[model samples]
Target: MPELPEVEAVCRKLRRDALGASIVQLRVERPSVTRPQDPAHLESETPGRRIESIERRGKNILIHLSAGHILHIHLRMTGNLYVIPDVRFRPSLARLWIELDGGRGLIFEDSRVLGKVHLHPAAHLARVLKDVGIEPLSSAFTLDNFTRAAKASSQPSKIFLMDQRRVAGLGNIYAAEALFRARVNPRQSARSISKPKLANLHTAIQDILHHAVSSADAAYAEPGHFAEGESFPCAVYDREGEPCTICGKPIRRIAQGGRSTYFCPRCQR
Candidate 1:
């Protein structure tokens, strides 16, 4: 699954290329995608609407429409959106295509078939995404706020970070990066972190994520061309058995809350 940065990259591309485009064609090659809309209902609701803007909320993409509706997309694992010139362009294995004005199209291709698309009002969607926690990048999330949120959960530091209801958009990769940067063990209790260290953690999380976003932008020629930022984008996520970038110690891996967490055991904590 693409984390916050990857989703942000996708949103930037969608906004630049697909925004303000009319939905001239709504092609559903895979019946499973529109199953929620149902063929008849989906056809009635999708066409003729113009995309006004595209924005990211946590890991979801909100495609604003002029018709008082929004198309919400969650590119759950292996899903990506493509924009190309040819009208003949279809999903290489695309399950859905929304044709914009002219020959441009927003194609949703998912090899794993786990991605989802739904149409709803911006007002009504709060119910679906309300449980998601604060955007760490948002102005509202602060050091004090992070401490309060983390202290509320006595769970492992990794668990506290991974909980979307506690801190939004943190996946294992960035979680590992942030914890390693904090020099705190992933298994430490969230409540045990001191104010200064927690402050470091707050700074570390934002810094690491911001570094990744900038690195990703620099690493790709176009935002639409992001190849694989998630496979291993930083210090410890996939550096297991390799020398730690900071301390030269062998990186290690462990399973936490069903996700594999990578860290420099000797340096962390």
Candidate 2:
């Protein structure tokens, strides 16, 4: 469950480090790791084509190619991307590798078999992502729609946030963090939240995600201190019995929608 911030970090690395590169060769150990098109077709189309720009739609990383194709990476759980100049120094559990002109390459390393890579023409990208909801950071995610969607559901606020169909890119970690930031209990009814709190929740979601992305960028720019696979210090997530950052009370965990939510009862309620 690499959330929006994590995905954003990977895309930034791809843009800054992997762009302007040429693919000399490719190897796929796990075909399911990425959808297999004709390698011959990709070899002809990808090589000599520049990586024009990098963008993200929802949780998907779109690597825009000069050939009018987009190499999309959906890093599912336990999926990691490594950009290394030495094939010998590549990370473990590599599913695929795209060798560049030099020694550099984009390595798709994932222990879990959940990650997926897809190549699509530029003309079909919009259609491919048409079902995704407006990005939470975008201006299109108005408060009205946010509130209306939440109210329309009988699910808990925590559960509603995890619904990818209603809102894209929010996973367990972010949902818990944003709920703590908004001071909303995870078990509370979505429609029961007050208007002022709803607004606060919206702002909290945006602020937390923005801050996370900023920290991710800082980590990417300086990878020495950016320990790979490191997660940010969270207020509630993964801290089952830890002390609340805001209050002295202990953080609690409850199972909802078959997922565990960590929060401080005092702080969130």
Candidate 3:
């Protein structure tokens, strides 16, 4: 799944290459990708409207169009957007292809077919994303705000961090990495964590996310890094039995909210 950093990187690429480009055509390879909104409607309405701006809200991509409509796309699990020359060959699993005016095309490819696409009026965007919580990178995610939310929740700290309604754009990978970086146990009760630990966790979340975005910016610039597989730097994520970066003890893997969480037992108490 593409989290905040990966999604933000994609948004930056779109803003650079796809912004201001008028849509010449929209081809929906799979109708199910645009559920609730008819593919016919998207094909008819999306063309002729220029991409005004691109923004990232949580893990969702919002492409504001010339008119009142907004192109909303969620790369749920395996989906990715690529801007290639119109003459370039399309991928086998390409779901939606938006032909641009400058011989370029934006392709949305999803191997698992779990992604979502919607074209809705700007007025309906708030309703569509009403469940998304505050952006952790924004001014709203302060230490006080984090502490209050943590104190109010009884869920484990890792689960609390992954809740979209509480902290948007955080997934299993980053949550585990953030918790490990903060030296906080993933299984610790949210409310039982001390104020100092909560403050550390808050800082760790922002720091890790910022660092990941920076790394992604560099990686996306390199050829084939985004399209091809690239390993992301992580201290304690999916490295079960690996030596802890800080302590020599082996990194432990535990299940929280049915998701695997990796942490150092000696370093993260």
Candidate 4:
């Protein structure tokens, strides 16, 4: 799944390339990828509509269009969005293609087909995302708000961080990295964390996510990194058995909520 940083990266790219461009056409190769249970609505409503802006809420991307319509996309897992200035060759598993003015195109490709595309009125976007939690990068996600939410949960700290209803846009990678940075064990219960420790965790979350976005932006600013699909830099995520960057102890991986969480067991206690 594309986490907050990845989604935000894609959102920024869309805002730069796709905004103000009129939707020339829409194609859905796999019908199940779209919502409303009807693929025609996407094709019918999107044409000739100019893209106003693109934003990221939680892990979903919102393409705000003229006429008060919003196109929502969830890149669940193994899903990616690419902007092609000129279509030299279409990539494999390209599920949805949006033809734009000036011959530029946006392609949504997912090998697993777990992603979803939905079209709704801009007014209904709030309703559609009603269940999503606060944006972690927003000013509203204050330390008090974070502590209050943590105090109410007994789930493991990593699992708590992954809960969208608690704090939006956190996934296994960020959760583990944040926990390690705060020196808090991922297996610790959320409510068992001290206020000071929670404060550290809060700071770690914001700093790590912001740094991830910056790194992504830097990478994409380069000419060919986006089309080549380069992997984002990470501190400990997917680094199982690697030496901890801080303590030099081998990092560990554990199963939490059926997801693999990587952390420095020696450093994160």
Best by lDDT: 3
* Local distance difference test, candidate 1: 0.80
Supply the global lDDT for candidate 3. 0.87
> What residue pairs are clashing in model 1?
91-94
Kindly list the per-residue Cα lDDT of model 1 for residues 188-246, writing each as its tens digit.
99999878889988998888778776655444336446475643458898778999998
Rank candidates, lDDT, best first. 3, 4, 2, 1
lDDT of 2 by residue, 1-269 (tens): 47888788888877778878877776777767655665445545666667788898778888887768887788877776757867666665887778876888788878887887777899999898887776899997899989988898878999988887777888899899999989998889888998988999999889888888887766766753334434466889989888998887988989998889999999888
What is the TM-score ranking, best to worst?
3, 4, 1, 2
lDDT of 3 by residue, 1-269 (tens): 58888899889988887888999999899999998779999999998999999999999999999879999999987889868876257777789998899768899999888999999899999998999988999999988888888888999888998998888999888999888878888889889988888888899889989988887766776654465224568888878999998887999998877778899999988
Per residue, candidate 4 scores C-alpha lDDT tens digits across 1-269 of: 57888788888877777778898998898998995458988999899999888888899899899999998999987777868886435676889888888877788989899999889999998799998998999998999999989999999999999999899999878888889889889999999998899999999999989988877766666654563223455668889898988888988888888889888888877
lDDT of each: 0.80, 0.80, 0.87, 0.85
Candidate 4 runs further than 4 Å off: 227-233
Name the lDDT value of residue 94 in candidate 1.
77
Clashing residue pairs, backbone N/CA/C < 3 A, model 2:
none
lDDT of 4 at 3: 80
Better candidate number, 1 or 3, judged by lDDT: 3
